[model samples]
Target: MSRLTQAVVLLLFGGAILRASLTDLYLRYVKEGLRPFLIAAGVLLIAAALATLWYSLREGETPDDHHEHDAPASGAPGDDDGHGQGHHEPRVGWLLILPVLGLLLVAPPALGSFAAGQAGSVSAAPASDSDYPPLPPGDPAPVGLLDYASRALFDDGKSLTGRNLRLTGFITPASDGSPMLARIVLTCCAADGRPIKVGMTGKVPLEVPADAWVEVTGVYSPHRAKDPVNDVDVAYVEVTSWQEVPEPKQPYS
Candidate 1:
């Protein structure tokens, strides 16, 4: 790339690092599909800056010649425009090291237990009708597990007991052979999250391991299950089909 283009690339890469460091939203939502691209762009920018710097230093100068006696005297010190060009090309590249190191050393800690405590699901109240949106015209409306949880809890599981729904989440283990539990990840913070789980009977794919992303289509129903002191009494959501998906870039709680 041209020296000007390389300079712009370095500047933009530095800006991305600064933006990701300064804003939680950028780290969470914006980087979901962008981690590999961002890293590749950073590498390209660094390489271009180094190449430009090398070219600036070597241009118009033979290996055997320093300052020839016949060469015209320069106007003054620092008068060669190209002399200091190498110095600035890398300034932006150097600026990117900070955030890179930060992520490598310590990925910003997961959205914590504290956040989950504060942001308990709105469906916590079973009598609230406002938790659900109007169902579309169909036998089953494919919805997020969070939506199912909110509506189920809103009506004390009355509205969802017989309705078919689809939800996506990662697997969590249960004593039964089938995946009886699942959790959706929230990137930035748990306050904005509502991970919904189900205790359903069916064959969970053996290949779909815990933490593996999966989309599950199922029917929501209320069935009694053993309640643990630590975990809440969960309603069984029957599974019809489960398919694994790629792990998202911004994995979260």
Candidate 2:
């Protein structure tokens, strides 16, 4: 392709990278699904830029070469001194200023609570089929601590209505005047995450201070009546075991 075409391609690819890096949707969804496409676009852009640079440096009969008002061959057009070298305008290195400014001074912020409001409620609705194994009808059931927390906050304690779960996450203090609750994040997967409030009812260890990570095996039970989503009766779980552990990345469920 022509130098202009190559430059256009570079600009297009660079724009894609810039936009994706800045947008929230790209961070949340497109980051994973379109990774390969981004990589390919990067390679194509580099190749196009290099090809354009080579073309610019080569002795070429472009439209600019066919100018009527010229000097010599080596000088300008016709007035060749045989030793004179043609003078071309310098490449504008400052064209990269915009991208550099964006990278160095305007780094994107993390997806904050503002996003949670618009991202729509996460669906923890019961599976239509019996995909999940049936929980025992006994007093306590097996469940993840995070799962119970999500249910209590959003599903009205319905998540733990008849099941028990085992979950683990770091500890964070409840804000002043807030209910007695602990927060944990389930990140990239449900494993690494951001902290969401978990209502704490049963005895918590005194040794486990704020920010101390822990693995809590527990039985799901109702706690409060504040259901953020549907006003379903919310609840906390009975903590069976709590042991401190190191924090993991990808915090937030």
Candidate 3:
């Protein structure tokens, strides 16, 4: 690619990064902690692109003066059979436009039910101990899927015995066509995401579509079953109420 093309590409890429980082869109691909780094990188790229463009334009305006004062030596590395030939960039450099377009024009959505279905195992951290702290104070305390699973499996449902909990996640259908609430856990980015699932029973809407985000108020149920795909323990919840909700700003936890 020519220097002009390189500068343009850098500008577009940096703009796309800024656009995503300045809003919640970046959360779809990366964790929130990386926002500062992304913004800094975008700023640096834009500066570099502007500098390169300025230099290219200045050099273009004074090419004749430089050529008259400092001509290349004969048989130099860049000479082609006694004719001066500039370096040419490979065509592969153009492929970068694909990601630029993808980010700028149509940023991809967060991982959802499809990704949850394809994964064999749910990601859960080992319980630190058999005893867990009591649930926080709330009539319908908000809880994460992983936390509920840990308590259900390791603490024997003691902490969750009578507490009503509220969970927010997208619906992923289980093997028997029952809806299961799920949220993706990301260690770094979407590429490393894994789903944490909770089987939903009692009052689950039969017509809920897969991947629809919902908030369900339920109590932990001792009923547990091994995952069909990975044999890991899957927790259950007896949902008393549920309502479809918009997807959260941060889709992954």
TM-score of each: 0.48, 0.44, 0.86
Clashes of 2: 37
Please report the candidate that would top lDDT against the real structure: 3
Ranking of predictions according to TM-score? 3, 1, 2
Error of 1 at 189 (Å): 2.3
Best by TM-score: 3
lDDT of 3 by residue, 1-253 (tens): 6677778899999999999999988999999999999999999999999998798787773423434344456566654534446433347978999999999889688899999888754746556765687788898999888999888877878889888999999998887878888999988899999889999778896788999999999998888877777778898999999999999999998
Residues 1-253, candidate 2, lDDT per residue (tens digit)?
Answer: 3354445556555555645544432343232445556556666666776676567658453535423324334433535335554444344633654564554356453343333322322333444453444454554454444455555556555545555555554454333323323333333422232334455556565456555556666766655544354433334666766667665332333
Q: How accurate is candidate 3 locally (lDDT)?
A: 0.84
Pairs with steric clashes in candidate 3: none
Residue 29 in candidate 2, Cα distance off native in Å? 9.1
**Considering lDDT, which of the candidate structures 1 and 3 is the better prediction for this target?**
3
